[model samples]
Target: MSGQHHVMVVDDEAAARDMVGEYLSLHGFRVTLCDGGPALRRAMATERADLVVLDLDMPGEDGLSVLRDIKRRAPVPVIMLTATAAPTDRIVGLEVGADDYLAKPCELRELLARVRALLRRLAAPAAVPGSAGRTETVRFGTKILDLAAHVLRDDEGRELPLTASEFSLLKAFAENPRRVLSRDRLLDLAGARDPDAFDRAIDVRITRIRRKIEPDPDTPAYIKTVRGAGYMFMPEGETR
Candidate 1:
């Protein structure tokens, strides 16, 4: 499966790109090396990448900007690598839809582990029991969460892009509607528990989900904040 998937590594430094590309290739994964955002965009234009390993500090079009553009164009998972020690920097990466982040000078083994974990999660199916021919869906606001396809579709049936992490989080909410789930519990249910994940990571992910499934993210009707408790999924939206 790793051999069949393509991973793109985008970094301004030749040594950095070569190192990651070589490591992934050795691990039976197809790899592409890009010098910067423009190179990444060109590669993406010609062919699809299953996932992206992007470096935050680049000469032009920083990783955050590149990540925003990539998310706008596709739902491919991205793991950001930043040398910045600031938690705010990592949080900002998450805000722009990064699936995960790693500090610069990261261990190759850890990077490989993260890549495999994310890919596995993306390929894993929701454990919803249903008849073989039937589609499993859950309603969130005006959108339909397609559990089978790992997508959210609007009223007109157009697909709203969702990352693996986002889909997992939404599935957690759908499976336990109306139940208040604390951030810790939510992370456990979503299989998104990361040692480096901050408390606000869940909040950022919820914000992203709301932007897709809520009628108005500012005044969320589907997932409501329970003051200090966490959030509750109101499948019927706000009660009349």
Candidate 2:
């Protein structure tokens, strides 16, 4: 990881963009400001951004559209910003590949912390390289999770679509197989350190991951949910 991470902020409102970008800059991040999707595209064409802070309610080509494009082109981490507290809004963003989200009028301190946590998540794998603590791959059911490549492929080597949050959550489960993980503990392990990020968000990612790796998502055999506790990944389920 570099000494200063480059973060691109995309918001329609100038005030909102300036406020967020300036705050991130003050916290030792190199900030790039863009008003909408076009500017973001142009900036991305010239230089790469370590992560993106995207606003959901932009006029033309909303945040979801931009997020889709970003994932298609580069697949960098994203933290969505929105004014609405509606669960649906955040869930939609997450489903569309947003790594995490923050509601409007957010505390800069919280955003900074979230940014640091996300960077740490991205850096953790690199720090271990090929040492004994590093995982090359994890097997479950018929799917093979490439931890180094950050991908899930089937028996035929068909890659699946997995968002950053889902990948992080799945990795956490695989690393601590058969041990019950409370929602709060899962959040910390998944690099989601924001108080505003609800535990239900973890449930959403779990549901998404279950669809990919579980034989039957409805009755998940890999990531089983304890009635009163949290989730536990069944280590014995690996067929390979």
For lDDT, the strongest prediction is 1
lDDT of 2 by residue, 86-135 (tens): 77778787767788888898899999888888877766672123446665
RMSD score of candidate 1 (Å): 2.0
Give the poorly placed runs of model 1, Cα more than 4 Å off. Answer: 131-133, 189-197, 238-240
TM-score of each: 0.92, 0.84
Provide the global lDDT of candidate 1 against the true structure. 0.87
For residues 1-240, what per-residue lDDT tens digits would candidate 1 score against the true structure? 798899999999899889999999999999999999889999999999999999999976888889999999999999999999787788898888888888889899999998998888788776565535777888999799988888899989999889878888888888778888898888765543456665788889999999988878999999999988888999879552
lDDT of 1 at 227: 82
Candidate 2: C-alpha RMSD after superposition: 3.3
Model 1: per-residue Cα lDDT at residue 12: 93
lDDT of all predictions: 0.87, 0.81
